[model samples]
Target: MARVDAAWYVTAGWALDLFQGRQTRDHDDIEIAVPAHGFPDVRRALSEFELYAIEDGLAHPLTPETLAISHQTWVREPATGLWRLDVLREPWDGNTWIFRRDSRIRLPRTRVIAYTEDGIPYAHPEIALLYKAKAVREKDEDDFAAVLPLLGPSRRNWLAKALTLVHPDHRWLEALRAGSTDTAAR
Candidate 1:
């Protein structure tokens, strides 16, 4: 794989593991988020692999038009047909990380992301949880359960406010508001 110097952060289910400082479960594919504006750099870096824009349950070779419309892309090795990466193009305003659901809700990229001791960047657990909130699947639920207890007041408060804006009536709001650290009941 080729390496590129760009702002990329581990996201989704894998993000929870990064925040927890360990591997919590097996991951089928690694997920990374890049600013929509920097997608060209990513494409150049992964030029050896096949990149497909995933739209409405279909995979299409990425073209300028497809790149403009699709938010998610999957990278695979053509020979083996093995999916290697899941890339999420995220909205950004210079250095701010704009919430995909609500552009009005944004934070400085530095504040919304965390890095490991070795300098690997990952989305903050709260931000990852916010994305997971949209689809409360079994894995999402498990991820939420694992990360909730690790959140402190500031993180919890931030997530609560974000949820209020994006999903006012979300069930997780109550738990976050209550500052519940109980993961067992989840």
Candidate 2:
């Protein structure tokens, strides 16, 4: 794996684990978020790996135009056909995190991301949960359950507001409100 001196943060399930300070479960592959404009740096860093643009169940060699067509790119080792990494391209304004679903919702990169003991940056739990809101798969639900009890008031509040703005009637909003009440009770 090549390392780039660019802004990138671990996301998805692994991000939840990073916030909890431990790996809660097995992960199939690692997912990372990189600025849409900075993807070229990532590509250069991982030049040894074969990058494939994945969209609508199709995978093809990633080209400069691929960024405009797909938000995700999967990298693999050509020799062994082993998946190496999953890259998620995200909209950003310098050091700010822009919500893909709603560009109006933006936060400073510092607020939406945190660094591990080893200096690897990972998405904040609240931000990760916001992304998980759309899928609600068993794994996503499990991740929410695990991290909900651990969230502080600020994180819970931010996530609640974000959900309201983007999803409105999302069930997680109710759950987050309930969790807030529970936290207050404790």
Candidate 3:
């Protein structure tokens, strides 16, 4: 593992696995996000790894100015030619964390990141679900179902609110709302 001098957290489906303490399903790759500003440091730390920007599902070597835009990058070891992890750049600031896709959705930095007992940091369930909600795939749906039971009232409510803001007609809203009502009943 390379040392990165930046703030990063496990996000997306892998984050749910971290929260659940086990792998709920197969993941093609692991995703870790760094605050947009901190990526330069991460890039410096991972200088040994080949970096490719993923656009339209294809990987291209990053351009000199590509880092200015927010996107996911594929890290590979040039010597081994083996694809490695993904580094997602997210919108963040000193006090607040903003959803990269939706600026309207924001939360305090403290509310977005949670640490495991082992000190590994991961995105809160709501943050993970919000990202997954952008394009609801089968695995995304499964992740939501598996984590719904584990989410408490506040987390469910936060996800529900964020989904409504970013994806007003999202199918998951029905389940999220129902889950909240159910959580309150119990």
Candidate 4:
């Protein structure tokens, strides 16, 4: 059984380092986006460990307030050293900026795979990149930049499909494509 039953955007130290092709030395956290309905499962997954709350980024602002609910789950052993896992969940609505529950855009389970310590599933590369592209953070920019090249021709349809869902205005779309193109030319 999985922790959450909604679409999840999985990004963490491993994921970040993976996309960036670098080593992450710090005990960084993993971020996930989940629908409100999955809140109970998310709570159940992390109940055995410590919990912490963090504010959602302003660029990717949350509607209710500054602080977005999140929890940390971990177990440390003297010989095996400390094992830490952070899981953050917020509502996700594909049609707009914030999260709202809609069965229509709900992702299939197959699209998510085991990639992190918590056994939390992650959205496919295309879905992950779609969310990353909207982030516009420095690290996220780097991530988008890094992943786009590796995507090559395989991601053409994925890109088109995401555009239909997100429906970004022309200027932002051009900027994203231009950035991708400029990176490619280099």
lDDT of each: 0.87, 0.86, 0.83, 0.46
A best-first ranking of the candidates according to their lDDT comes to 1, 2, 3, 4
State which candidate has the highest TM-score. Answer: 1
- lDDT per residue for candidate 2 within 48-136, as digits (tens), equals 88999988878878986765789899999989999989999999999988998899889998998899899889999999999988867
lDDT (Cα, tens digit) per residue for candidate 3, span 137-174: 87887888889989887888898898888889888777
> How many collisions per candidate?
0, 0, 0, 2
Task: Name the candidate, 2 or 3, with the larger lDDT value.
Answer: 2
Q: Which stretches of candidate 1 lie over 4 Å from their true place?
A: 181-186
The segments of candidate 2 whose C-alpha lies over 4 angstroms from its true place after superposition are 180-186
lDDT of 4 by residue, 34-128 (tens): 55556556656655544334434212222234234332222222354443544445444442323122233444445433354545455455555
lDDT string for model 1 (1-186, tens) is 236566888999888999999999888789999988988889899988999999987889999888877899999998999999999999998999998888878999888789999888899999999999986877887888788889998989999999898888777877787887444434
TM-score of 3: 0.91
Give per-residue lDDT, candidate 2, residue 173: 75
Q: TM-score, each model?
A: 0.94, 0.93, 0.91, 0.51
Query: Which residue segments of model 3 deviate by more than 4 Å?
Result: 180-186
What lDDT is reached at residue 21 by model 1?
Answer: 95
